[model samples]
Target: MRIALAQINPVVGDLLGNADRIHAALAATEVNGKVSADLLVTPELSLWGYPPRDLLFSAAHLEQQQQALDQLQQRLHAEQLDVALLVGVAEVAPDQQHPRLFNALALVQARGWQVVARKQLLPSYDVFDETRYFRASSSPSTLSLRVNNRDWQLGLSICEDLWVDEELHGQRLVGPDPIASLIPERLDALINCSASPFSRRKGTLRHELAARAAERLQCPVVYVNQVGGNDELIFDGASFVIAPGDDTPLLQLPEFAVSTEVWTAASSTDRLEQPSRAHQQANTPDDDLEALFRGLVTGVKDYATKCGFKAALLGLSGGIDSALVAVIAAAALGPDHVQSLLMPSPWSSSGSIADALALATRLGIASQIVPIQTLMEGFEATLTPALNAEPSGITAENLQSRIRGTLLMAMANQQGQLLLSTGNKSELAVGYCTLYGDMNGGLAVIGDLYKSTVFALCHWLDSPDAGACRAELGLGGSGPLIGQAILEKPPSAELRPDQKDSDSLPDYERLDPLLMDLIEQRMSGEQLIGAGHDPDDVKRIERLFRRAEFKRRQAPPLLKVSKQAFGSGWRLPIAAI
Candidate 1:
């Protein structure tokens, strides 16, 4: 049996468009003048896209979903294509109770499409809210197809169904063991369609989980993942096929890119006994820095294009955060369409201005020098008399940031471009960012990246290994897109004279590990202190992180790259102490 893995990026809530993309991928079945595969497999929720969220509640969304299936069926019949398709969809059952939908996989053969497998595991924790919308299935599903005058029993599972092994995850997700239940079925192959989001080292975990499943079932397991950025979540689709007793994958697909490739099952020994021929076609794994870089670029590209924006603009203050964001935007939206405004305040250094221009030139992006000195003087004059004194301290510092934010917003609105926020996770976690000031934008490109990670990514982009990525993204002929001067300098906001970030917060070197302990590890302040973190810094950071809830609530949607980003998964009450 030959199967095609259609690794695609689908826009959320675009059912008609998503269906059309699937139809197109299926139509391109010829490779070197030969039909590629007899069957096609799409990612989880490939029809309506992943995490439609509350849009699932809309009647029109449900209506369009059925319409999309009808259109896909017509296209398959009209073209007289003989390929069988396994597509993920939201299956609605009218006889069910409150939540009537099931995260389902439909088998589309010559007859038509029908629900073949309903997802039994609906994960509710950490960025998943499927329990609020989907009801779980009671039994695992198996599909039998006749190929080469022999019946092939195949077990079908959704994303979380294969993830139920407590040994790999430390604990179960309060659901029945879906993978183990399939053990009695004695299947030839297992297929899992996933829309799993990317986190640090998650690809390794996915590989391990699939390997374990293959070992238990004693069959080849194929994992298909959705690729693209959907709002806060970025899916790094590293689709592959693993067989029992094999150290490497039998077949491997590309990562962080869209693909449609075929793999043929061997007839002699069920394709499990032979060593993988895919080793000759396998690609090397990306290092952590490269993964982070691709995630940022993919996040910006999808957020802007899906939201109907062709151009992007950001406030470039010659700081590392803004500089890194500018580079990412240039790579994402193209340097020609990416615009940067050097909104230098009175306190901004001349060297900073020079560094910003040099970066713009190196990236081949258009830049404008927008001085805010006059705006500062005008605002001070307009408000000082009302208070009977000039605004000073934090208020004065925030005013400078607001002036630049306003200018950037105006440009974004006037030119109809998406504004990318440049604040990093360190600033956002500690409330070092102003509410409407540095936090204003349509999307936070690197909001999940800490200051330390930001520097590391920039350094990697400048290395020789990143040359192919730079060229692929159309970046300038560059040793480094981010200038060296911007790197070696002390990190500063430049809102006030010689104002370093350390003045407001601890050095990121000492701060990021403590933050990881608190945020991802969910450690308490006392626990962090006991683990050798600075007691004073931990106490202050906890207070700051708690107090900034309201600000984060009002800020733009941030792209998620970390295990626990400040997105939909991180919920906290603002009224609490």
Candidate 2:
């Protein structure tokens, strides 16, 4: 059997557009003509979107979905396409006696459509509220189709259905051995339509799980996923097919883009197109740079596109964070649309101005040199005498940042561009950044990325593979725009003279791993200390992390690239300590 995985990104409510995308996918593969497959699989909720959330309650949305499905069925019949389309949607059980809707898959056959049962498990933990909207089904859904003169029996499952064994938030959430029920009756394949979110090292984990399932089921498994960004979520579309008997994937599709690949048992010749390896390599300079750059570009484009903004503006401080944000802005919005404001202060050095101009010139974006020294003087005049004998420390330094922040916001307001915040995860975690100062922006690009990761990404962008075309056309030069100096220079805030980030915070070499353990792995301070991390360092970092919650609460909505991000997923009290 040759099946096509239609990896698609659909807007949350546009049923027509979603159906159109599904039609386009069907036409591309000509599911009935060249390749005779029993089924064509699409991502979960391909019609109404993965998690329609509160929108599911509206009668209008549900009516539109039914109408769209009717139209889809009519179109399929009109085209005389004999292939069975297994698609995910918000299914309303005829019995409407059921209180909630079901996260469902409906198999549209040549004759008519039938409900292939709703999800047995409705996930309700962190970032998911499936239980709030969807009601669980009692039995497995089995469907039969005739393909290539043979009857093909198949089973359907949605995103969270396959992971029955996994405990979510310390609670076991699903039935035991959901896949085992299908074993009693012979089945050709298991098609899972998913809308899984992206996270570092998640792909490897998914692959392992899929392989294990395939081995247990003794049938080929087709995994189709949604792509593109929806609100704070980004769906990485590295869909693949696993052969039952073999460990290697039979077919693989690329990530963060729309792609299609066919998988067949009899066909000995098949090629694999994998997702970008930039995220997989943590230590490699080139790959890390490409990953971070791509992540930022996606972040900028999606945040602007989804939020209805066209242009981006940022403060260029001649530092790596600002430089990286500038490059990402250029890539996302065209150079004509990306505006850089050089907010040099009285404390700012000449070398900073020189480097900022050099970068702006290389990138060919509009640049404005705004001297914030006057603004700093005005702030000092206002605050000096009010302070009796308090030492001038972080408060004084923050005044400079606030001045620059005001100037950047002024530019963004004048030019109608969204200001991109340049503070990274490391600084944000420890409250190293100033609220309403460096923290002011519409979207926080690379806010989820660590400081050390930012350096690695800069180095990668300077390498050869950085030659990949800018996501937007007619913006960047053919090759990389990052300079060797930007990649090699020591990272600093430049808020104070001769201040390096290392002066206060732990070295990134030590910092990022500890953060990964603490945040991503959810390890306690004692656990980190037990795992060879210094106890004092862990204690300090933990303290900083706990204290910074209030600042993060005020921070703009951040683009999430990790499993546990400071954004919506990692919700905690401001004073947890």
* Model number with the top TM-score: 1
**What are the per-residue Cα lDDT tens digits for candidate 1 across 469-567?**
788778844587776898888999998998899998989999999988988899998899999999999989999999888898887899999889998
Model 2 regions more than 4 Å off: 31-38, 93-99, 109-111, 164-174, 264-293, 384-391, 468-480
lDDT of 2 by residue, 293-374 (tens): 5555766787788677889899888888888888888877778788888988766778878888888998888898988777
Lowest-sum lDDT 10-residue window in model 2: 275-284
Candidate 2 overall Cα lDDT vs. reference?
Answer: 0.75
Model 1 C-alpha RMSD to native? 1.6
Clash count per candidate: 0, 1
